[model samples]
Target: MSVVSMLTPGISMNSFEATAHVVTQLEVQRVSYMLVGALSSNAYGIPRATKDADIVVSFDSIGVVEFAKSLGVGFKLDRQMRMETITNSIRNIITYTPTNFDIELFRLSQDEHHKERFQRRQRRWLEEIKREAWIPSAEDVVIQKLRWKRRKDLDDAENILAVRAKKLDWDYLNHWTMIHNTNDLLKQLRDECPNLDVLDEE
Candidate 1:
């Protein structure tokens, strides 16, 4: 089954509206952030259900927390410096009580791949909310997830590969995957998605 087929839920407009609101607020406050996770995945890959939107920001937790709190009211910062399981990277998670939506903020890392992905984010029309927003590229999404190596991340990577193989920058993807030791997993994802033949040229 394709990613859209295996995932049985539709995206929530309310979640997107909330994201747009927050994104606008962040920009107004001069915070640099790029949308990641399934929320942004809707751009190039299958639209999957997710309650939260993950963002990589140029600021750290301290700056992000202060900004989140000043956004009128109801946005609560839950945890700061929370380390993710597989990647061991720290994130600041803030929840909007009114919508129960989480915005997980990750600090931009010095890692080559992270820097590249953050710099490569492009503005695209988000159909979910009918607005343009900065979103990670399809290749970046796969690269980000596969580096994490979690079960769900793997599924997400596979899903992106299934639908966006031809569109991805294979050279860029392969370079980082080899550095991150995920080349085999990348190969497996391509193999699983039978139609992903673009990599065969390499």
Candidate 2:
């Protein structure tokens, strides 16, 4: 298990309470969702700045329309993007005007890798916020960051590798990276952050 002492944090998120508040709603609705993106990366890697939260949910029982209502009034949702890449999902965004905290929802897809990652997710208590959160496994988070390949996301990937390389499931990571053709990228990250590969002398 991963456990780090909380000596405050360097991450400056727009709203952690709003993120936790929405997570409570997802739990109440019995929805399967995992926190991804910068907010989540901050937990695994280094704490930095994050504007919004990315939650991938299976909209089988709960939809964005309903989730928006739970977010209270003045929250606008953008149900645009007919079809996106990989997951082939539309952008179902719920923006909380009070804090400008946006929760971008991606409808679960039948993609094999996504399914695996979703199934691999685990819930843990976040002591910093005193709430439980459904977070992607460390390995999956790293892989997704690489797949996204945004400049910030690539940075997140490197940071995560630097911090979590010891705890990460190398077998699982290698399997998916090879499938996604990101094995080279993974190797490069490991090269740059060589300490990530240095397991304790145990």
Candidate 3:
């Protein structure tokens, strides 16, 4: 189902409303997208507060400026898009005026893992946004977080490992980690988390 159809208007405050607004616009344009970043981690890991919303979109039907314009008032799309070094993907930023919240729209990249994760995204009900949205799988979240390797990302990876160790597919996680040269990091994070008996067999 389209994200727009699942949304109930006025269900949240400014920050959440801003995210829902973006999701609504993406659905209206028929763009394929999946929510990522802290929100995605919160689903499989520990929940936390974040001022920004990250979404990876397969945007092609329209130009960024036109798409921004279509978002209507209270949203300003940055004209200067950036290239993310790790994934080598372009990202567009949007400022939701009311709450000063930034919504990051990343263009889906050609990376093998990026493609795999996007395809593997799962639909889940997000209480914060008061709607169902697509989010990365637990394994994918760990892989991507390790690849990013930021302090916060590592912390998130550790939490997800702690929460979903046994349920995660180690083979799939191992495969991507090997390809990305992040196997050692993944192993380290896994080692740090307690009660990961599932890693013993793998």
Report the lDDT tens digits of candidate 1 across residue range 1-202.
1111111122333556656666766666667788888877767766778879888788634486677765546567875478665454578887766678887888777666778887889987777655677788888889888887888888888878877777778998999889889999999888887565643232
Ranking of candidates on lDDT, top first: 3, 2, 1
lDDT for model 1 comes to: 0.73
- Candidate 3 accuracy as TM-score: 0.90
Best TM-score goes to which candidate? 3
Deviating ranges (above 4 Å) for candidate 3: 5-13, 196-202
- lDDT for 95 (candidate 2): 77
lDDT of each: 0.73, 0.74, 0.85
Worst 10 residues of 3 by lDDT: 4-13
Q: What's the alpha carbon RMSD for model 3?
A: 3.4
Q: Tens digit of lDDT per residue, candidate 3, span 6-81?
A: 4343444488777877787787888889999998998887788997999999978776788888776777898898
Per-residue C-alpha lDDT of model 2 across residues 1-202, encoded as one tens digit per residue: 3222222222333366656666766776777888877767777777777777788887667677887776555466876744558667566777767678787887777878788889998786654445768788878889888888788888888888887777778999999999999999989888887564453212
What value does the lDDT take at residue 33 in candidate 3?
90
Native-vs-model 3 lDDT? 0.85
Location of the lowest summed lDDT over 10 successive residues in candidate 1: 1-10
